[model samples]
Target chain A: MEYLLDGFADGLMRVLRADPQVMLAAWVTIKVGFWATILASLIGLPVGFLLAMGRFRGRGFAITLLQTSLGLPTVVIGLLAYGFLSRRGPLGFADLLFTPSAIVIGLVVLAVPLVAVFSMTSVASVDERVRETALTLGASNGLVAWTVLREARFGMMAAVLAAFGRVSSEVGIAMMLGGNIEGYTRTLTTAIALESMKGEFGFGIALGVVLLAIIFVTNLLSRYIQRS
Target chain B: MEVFFLDNVKFRFETDLVLDIERVTVSSGEVVLLTGANGSGKTTLLRVMAGLLTPEGGVIRYKGEPIIFGKPGLEHRRKVTLLAQEPYLFRGNVLLNVSYGPRARGMNISQANEEAEEAIIKTRCEGLIHRDAAKLSGGEKKRVALARALAAGAETLLLDEPISHLDEENSKLIVEIIKELAASGITLVVSTHIPEWASTLSVKNVRLAYGRVV
Candidate 1:
């Protein structure tokens, strides 16, 4: 056990010294996670607001569908995205298979429902009079929607943070869709998996520590926002 | 000089008829008091006039021009404002809440702040300008909301039970402010259960029962 601890300490020192391989993997993880979160927010914020506020048929069903999708398996998403982006597929012309863009697309699919459902729930929880008051104060329809969004901004931010956390830690989509290519698509989770399989437990533990730190910071930020 | 004219207006919610008024006209710069018991449709009438709720069937005119339900243009909407019994303030300081209307209407921040500060001063809430609007007392929130409506420069103001939960001092201050706004040629439609407000403003009283003018 002491030997293991010593190896972990040594591995952490190497990581602290900024190993190029680990740094490259961290960069890819950050880029893929941020882009996926951005795409998800762009698609989710408006749809979620409409789901919460618009009077329409099938709104309940749409919300239920999105809510049910929150627990979707990462591997299933990876496989599905792989099918769509693989050679001879309808979108094969893009040649995006095993690329960071493919990983981003898969992660976005996983994140959109999370951001959407949370945003809808948050917007729905806003005070009923907020819309009426804004409208009565001479705000246009667009402005009323903006007001609702502003009121729910914190919840929406939490949703974004949650999406980033999920995609950044997910290994299935990164391994399958990203192909975990060295210096290109390799991410923290996939590198950890590879290092562990190769009996490099110390290096894997170091990566695991970094991943845990990221999750901790994300959760901390989310909790702070919720409290404020 | 008429501000609003409603003829044959009918509003239904689900299967129940809520409001059915044959005719009511509000002239410019007049204080019209709306008094009715609970569920008597006084609030519904104010809401319809504010363009927040659409009448199922009606011929409504604003300044002698036909005003369509659900599509009252921004300019027309800017000319009218409503204050519910319990008003809602956005998540911000008093200054931000008061400046919302002008900012929503595309006014620059500096100009909107100027108008908002002026309204806050007029409503006697200048001391609370930097305070969190959501944490204010009932009377202060109402006053801030009224100041927001004032900042909009609305020609017509519809207030529903503005002083319902206020103390005597606050109530008197609001009444004086309303009187001053009326004196400035702004049409006021105030709904309340208190008889003193109508008498205090010396306004014409219009009563409603079962959605009909009495």
Candidate 2:
């Protein structure tokens, strides 16, 4: 118990002192998580909006498929991405395996369904009268769609924050896809895993603290947006 | 001039027939009052007239040009606006809500504000101009919604249950506003459940019973 307390104190000191390795891992994590979340939002928001508003054959099937994807394990995504990005694989020409970009690819796969499902819920919750009101006010179809999206803006933001939270904290994809390469592809989650396994509990705890802070900040922003 | 001519128009909700008018006409600059009991299809008829709903089968002519059932042109929409029974104000201040119609029609912000202010004054909602629309009382929301429709400058207005839940003073104010609107030669089709309310306005009455003109 004393040793654990010492390790916790050492972790706090290292974080306060801005240790170089911890800082580099944090920066890489932010960069990869940011890019993955942005790419996923760009693809997911519109797809979710269409799924919520559009009426067509097989819409129910598409929603079911999206919901199922939300529960997919991150390691499975990492494995699939590895297969596609590995040398002698379909995307081997890009030579992106064991790199930060590879990790980003995996994280994007893990985050898209989350963003899409949340966005669909947000848009679907808007009052049906909004569409009718816009139409009666002489707004074109495009304008009506824009109006609905604006009304659902906070929910869309929450979706983005939720995606960021998921991608930032996930370890499976970071480890399998990034190979935990130091000074290059290393991320906070991967570093935490590697450090703890190598008996570097202080360093692992420091990175864990940073990861928790990132997730905490995201949740705070989401709650603030929802209240506003 | 006949502003709207509906012939054999039919509308349904799933399998339930809602509006089935054999014939109806509204001449330009006329006030047509639609009075009906609950579920008598008054709101549905107004929605069809405003080109917001497509009738299952019918020929609707606007200004002598045929309005295709499902494809009411933008021009048709711009010239006709509907005020719902429970109007929805956008999430913004009253000025922004009232200016939405003018903005949607491509007016610049300043010009739209000018139109909105004029309409707001006319509807006696100038005091609520800077107030958030979502914070408005029920009567205020209705008046602000009317101001929005007015700012659109449409030649025709379709109001559904305009005085349904208003206090006596507010109801009187709305009736006076309707009179003023008619005097200005804007075609009006106002719906109400009370037959006595229709008598307050010099309007031609169209009574509905179970989706048909009685």
Candidate 3:
């Protein structure tokens, strides 16, 4: 108990002093989470809108595929990405194996289905009249869709926050694809995993605190958006 | 001259027939009243005419040209506006709701604002222009919605039960506004259950029973 308390205190000190390695890992973690979430939204929002609004055949099958993808294991995504990015693989010409970009690719695969499914549900829940009213008011079909999406923006932001939370803390993709290279691809979650395994409790605890803080701020922002 | 005509119209919901009007025609700058009891499909007919609901089978022609449902429907839809029985306001203030139509049609900000303010005055909702639309009372919301429709400046207006559930004062206000709008030469199609109030206006009447013109 005494050792644990001493280690926690030392972790707080390291976090406060902004250790270079710890800061680098934090930056990488944030970069992966942010880029993955942005890419996911870019792909997810339009797909979600079409799923909710367009009258297309096989939509149910598409929706089922998205929902199933939501539960896909992170390591499975990492392995699939690794398979393509590996030297002997089809995409080897890009030379992106075991890099931060590989981790971002893995995280994006994990986040897209999550964001798309949540956004579809959110946009679907809006009242049908909102779209009708916009249409009656001379808004084009694109403008009508824009109107509905705008009305459900709080819910969409919630989807983004959920996506960010998911990718930021997940360890499987980071460990498998990032290779946890120091000063390059090292991220907070992988660092914590390595430090704890090596019994460097103070270092692991500090990284954990940083991770928690990022999630905390993200959730706080989502709440503010929702309430507003 | 005929503004539009629906010929051989048929609309159904699942196995239930909602509308089966053989033919209906409206001229430019005319006032037409749709009156029927509950579930008589007055609302459905208005929606179909507004192009909000596509009939299972029909051809709607505007000035002797066909209005196709997929892309050409937009041209007809832009010229016709529908005000639902239940008022729905967007996320912002009353001014935003009123200005939505003009802004959506590509009007500049100053032009949209001018039209919105004029509509607020016309609807007698001047004081409510800056208030949050979502927080307004039902009657207030209805008035704001009317202002929005009027500000749109569509050639044809479809109003569903515009004065059905309001107080006498509000009903009188809406009736006067409707009369004014009709006198200004804008085509009006109003749906209401109360025949007594509708009888006061000199307009062509169409009564429906079970989705068919009677």
Candidate 4:
């Protein structure tokens, strides 16, 4: 108990002092999370819109596949990305293993389904009258779609924030793909795992606090957007 | 000159026939009233006329030219506008709602604003220009929606239950606006369940019973 208390106090102090190693890990986490979420959103939003509004063959199958992927374990993603990015694998020529890019690639795979399914729910919630209203008012098909998306903006933003939270706090992809290299590819989750195992409890606790803070801020932002 | 002509039109909601109009014609600058009971296909017919719904089997001609339902129907749709029974105001200020039609028609901001202001004044919504459209009262929403339709500069307007659910004063105000619109030579097709409301206007009455004109 005394050791835990001491570690907590030391971690609080390190957080307040802005320790460089902790800050670097937090920065890497933010960068990887942001880029992965952006790429995921860019791909997922349109796919989601199509899923919700478009009438096409096999659409139900596609949506069910996406929903099934939402429960996919992160380690599986890490393993698949590893297989593709390893030197002897199919994409081996890219030489991307153990790099931040590899971590982002793995995280993107992890986040896309989450973003897409949430976006689909958000857009589908918009009233059907919105489309008819736009069409009756002379808006082209593209403009009508834009209007519907505008109405669903807040929910879509929540989807993006959810993706950010998922990727930022995940450990498996960062561990397997980034290899938790010091300074270059280390992230908050990876650092927490390594530091705690090495008995650097203060460092691990500090990173945990940072991670919690990030998630709290994201949730607050989501609530604010929803209320707006 | 005929503005709209429908022959052998049929529409169904998953095999439950909603509209089966044998023939109907609306002339240019005419005020046509569609009166029917609930579930009598008044709204469905209005939607079909607005080009928002394609009839299952029919021929629809606008100004003597046949209207194709897909990409080719856009031009005809632009020339006609429909106001829903429960109007949906876009997420923005009243000005934005009013300006949406003109903006969608490719007018510049200033030009759209000018058209919007004109319609707003006509609809007696000048004071609500900056107010959020979603927060308006039911009557206010209907007026703003009508103003939006007016600003589109369409040749024809179709209003579904425009005065339904409003207080007597608001209903009278809408009737006055309808008269004004009719006098201005804009083609109008208005649907309502109350026959007494249509008695006040000099309009061609097209009564419907189970989707058939009676």
Tens-digit lDDT string for candidate 3 (B1-214):
8987988788898889988887788899888998889888899988888888878888777667776553347787778899999967899999999999999889998999999999999999999989998889878888899999999888899999999789888888888899999889999999999867756677988888898889
Ranking by TM-score: 4, 2, 3, 1
lDDT by residue (tens digit), candidate 4, A1-228: 998998899898999999999899999999999999999999988889889889999999999999999989999999999999999999999999999999999999999888899999999999989988888888888898899999999999999999999999999999999999999899999999999999999888999999899989998998898888
Candidate 1 local lDDT, A94-146, one digit each (tens):
99998999999999999999989888888999998898888777788888888
Badly placed stretches (over 4 Å) of model 4 are: B70-72
Give per-residue CA lDDT, model 2, range B105-141, as digits (tens): 9999999999999999999998999999999988889
CA lDDT of each prediction against the hidden true structure: 0.88, 0.91, 0.89, 0.91
TM-score to true structure, per model: 0.90, 0.95, 0.92, 0.96
Model 3: per-residue lDDT, tens digit, A63-181?
Answer: 99999999999889988888988898899999888788989899999999989998999899998889889988888877888899989998899999989988999999999888999
Provide DockQ values for all models, in the order shown: 0.63, 0.73, 0.67, 0.77
What are the runs in model 1 whose C-alpha is more than 4 Å off? A1-21, A56-61, B71-73
Residue B4 lDDT, candidate 2, scale 0-100 = 92
Q: Residue B99 of model 1: what lDDT? A: 96
Specify the CAPRI tier of model 1. medium
**Residue B88 in model 2: lDDT:** 95
TM-score of 1: 0.90
Fnat of every candidate, listed in order: 0.77, 0.79, 0.77, 0.81
